[model samples]
Target: MPTHNDPDTFTFFPVLIGDIGGTNARFAILLDAYAEPKEFPILATADFATIDEAIQSGVLDKTSLQPRSAILAVAGPIKGDEIHLTNCDWVIQPKGMIRDLGFEHVEVINDFEAQGLAAASLEPEYLEKVGPGETHPSLSRVVVGPGTGLGVSGLVHARHTWFPVPGEGGHIDIGPRTARDYELFPLYEPIEGRISAEQVLCGRGMMNIYHAVSKANGTEPVAANPAEVTALWSQGRDSAAVETIELFATYLGRVAGDLALIFMARGGVFLAGGIAQKILPALRQPHFRAAFEDKAPHSELLGTIPTFVITHPLAALSGLAAYARTPIRFGVATEGRRWKA
Candidate 1:
């Protein structure tokens, strides 16, 4: 395979794109600049010892096309050559991928950055509006997702280019506000001392809320996992489960609203993750929007800022494909996050 090292004129043709999260890894291949991405089935991260093995068995073995470049969105910060996932055991080393998989170039980014990119360009059909508001094309936007962990990022449009700002916004401090929150907040399991947003916002966080609610009600917790909790909530048979889902929605809305205020994200605030999509009905309720617009002094401003749940399952892949096809359209910073042979 040929290699292109010139940063300004590099081409990412026949690219292998991946959205590697804590529990699952989704892969796809973009044949060229003009072709649509060919997607593959989702793979459990634990099934393979390394990402290269997973790619070889789950992607390369099934496709006839050879991918020269690899673009991966991982569930952690891009620190150095070796990237460790925040919630999984997979350690992604770009150099190892190039040496073992024979790729010419590799780029690793924070998973939420891909969501931010998708938010900047996703069409209306892929978005389900959560409440009433309009999108301001010229303003900034934010993307928050709660899956294996909480992912947060911001998108800004400047000089005709979309820029994604990725950070550990998931770890921001979150506190109780209402009387019910005061009763349940103390019972939640904290990471160290205080409760961060991720402490009660992700899959495990759902269970944390469930357990806390059960403890508050002085009843034994019935749900073992997030899915079971959701099922019980849907059936309305368990009060703890129902309250857990309701609290999760309210907390999500509060955090999203906080981010919207921070970025003044008039373009919109998008919710992307398994939990957000799975609990669409809960998010659509009045409580979610009420919590989102509860900001004092600026509640009216937030009311005009729209919120949406991203309906597309392969949204991160779409973002990577867009960047691979038209690199100039998005100002994705890849100084230390990119490796080339």
Candidate 2:
């Protein structure tokens, strides 16, 4: 990678930010400070093999303003300085890469964390409203996305600002409501003794549901793979694929409702990621909504809160940038660290 000179003048061009998920990595060249920065041009992961190659590509070359800062939203756990990408072969470091990428400051946050940050600043247009009523500004907002894996996070509203919490909620044991889930272990038991929400809510989760339903129906269950299943569904040729997606959405909605119950996320619930976008058209279907509001006695409480699908292509990138601007306190985790005014 080649190093470039930074422009001397101080103007707010969009900070070069990125969000790298299991499947793809997206980068931006902007001319503003926020996630909603003006004049953004996006580039795909397939366009370049290495992140550095992608950053220094023709897009950044056209900008006379050299990016002095950056933030990357990467999926998987960040243990110390090194990041071992779960879905990809890339390994990244925050402090070291800053110098390498010609950035004065850089941050590589958890992908879910980036989503949490983006969730805080989401506008009405970026979301597709599912359930009725308005978001309760006082309630905690749950953000869950079923993509490469089932990612979960929450934004707690305290006095003023939204505090983002990043955790391994996906690894938590799923509330297996149906007989199929109870019997799911025999297939995935080789990997672990029991399955988590991620096992049945992610991309592979779709396959797991398809096969389980196949066995339940007393027939040979066939859907080529995740991609093939999605493709078939796209063309409206596979009922199994459709059923699998429906089950996935239902379970996902149930999980969201449960999270809301836990966090009292009356603020709202957001379905994010590429997978949600693909299934947004189907989410309007009956079964999906039924499973979501299937809560016991207090089911009506969920009806009061709103549910939405985040449709923005670079929603996570916006979050990664927003989080980057937050101040880091010397001690304890508390509010007043991030300012958006």
Candidate 3:
């Protein structure tokens, strides 16, 4: 163990959190619960050989930062103690981890679930509007993010209380809205056999959409990576890139709209993940809202729901911290009480 940093090093007490995704695990310390998260340090998970190596070495020193609670926003489906990180190379046992980390409270939640919690604590400056309407703070909020993979979760506010509902809604077969989108279905079969919404809405999915469209349209795509495409789209370099971003935004809107309908999250929608931040300009187009409100007849309903993108980079850490300290009351593990999620 590394020796703890001198007490004088930190002027305030911050809760330590790790946002572990399929590609990146963001480690941060939060001084203020969710309002403002000071980015202490960011580490590329690939830099370390193992997840534990990176976190234990960077956050757990005998001295500098003291976090009594910890929450891990993980990418995979959170069942029980054994967590399988979808985009990562590891599965974790919470009991073992909590014990080894020496944390009095430790909780693991799906990345989307954490994102939902993070959404509740966002500051006004940390958000960018993707569509045309303002969010109604009193209504339920939906959280969607696209990174190495697409993650979805919701928060319903009733009488001023926010309740988080986490699900594997991302894995369902995607409902393609257009003929060109129909061709995109088979393209994902080789990987998932059954394409989930994320197959076309996330990081790699952006490439999939680009390549699929390129092949379908018989036009050579100019961009090399999704980032390049997003950059070019933002700069108005390639119309095709613009088209790709449109498709991405459209599909994302479809998914969000669907989730909103499912959860009846009439309050608002929260868009997160590292991807949305990069594609903000692209999402401002007319196509974004068109897809969002394309709901049958009830299109007027979507118009009322507000959508906001999470601009805070470390926003999800708050959710992880909250998860660690809150106990599950039933079904999945309530031997004396219950278990689930």
All candidates' TM-scores? Answer: 0.97, 0.81, 0.83
lDDT of 3 at 233: 80
The global Cα lDDT (0 to 1) of model 2 is 0.69
Q: What are the per-residue Cα lDDT tens digits for candidate 3 across 212-263? A: 7777778888888888988888888877677788988998888888888887
Q: What is the lDDT for 271 in model 2?
A: 90
Over the stretch 146-250, how does candidate 2's per-residue lDDT look in tens digits? 888888888887655666776778777765677755664455422367678888888888788777766666667667677777777778776777777777888
Strongest candidate by TM-score: 1
Model 3 segments more than 4 A misplaced? 1-14, 30-38, 61-63, 182-190, 320-341
In model 1, the runs with Cα more than 4 Å from the true position are 1-9
Single out the weakest 10-residue window by summed lDDT for candidate 1.
1-10
Q: After superposition, how far is residue 5 of candidate 1 from its true place, in Å?
A: 12
What's the CA error at residue 327 for candidate 3, in Å? 10
lDDT of 3 at 75: 82
Q: What is the C-alpha lDDT of each candidate?
A: 0.91, 0.69, 0.69
What order do you get sorting by TM-score, best first? Answer: 1, 3, 2
The per-residue C-alpha lDDT of model 3 at residue 34 equals 44
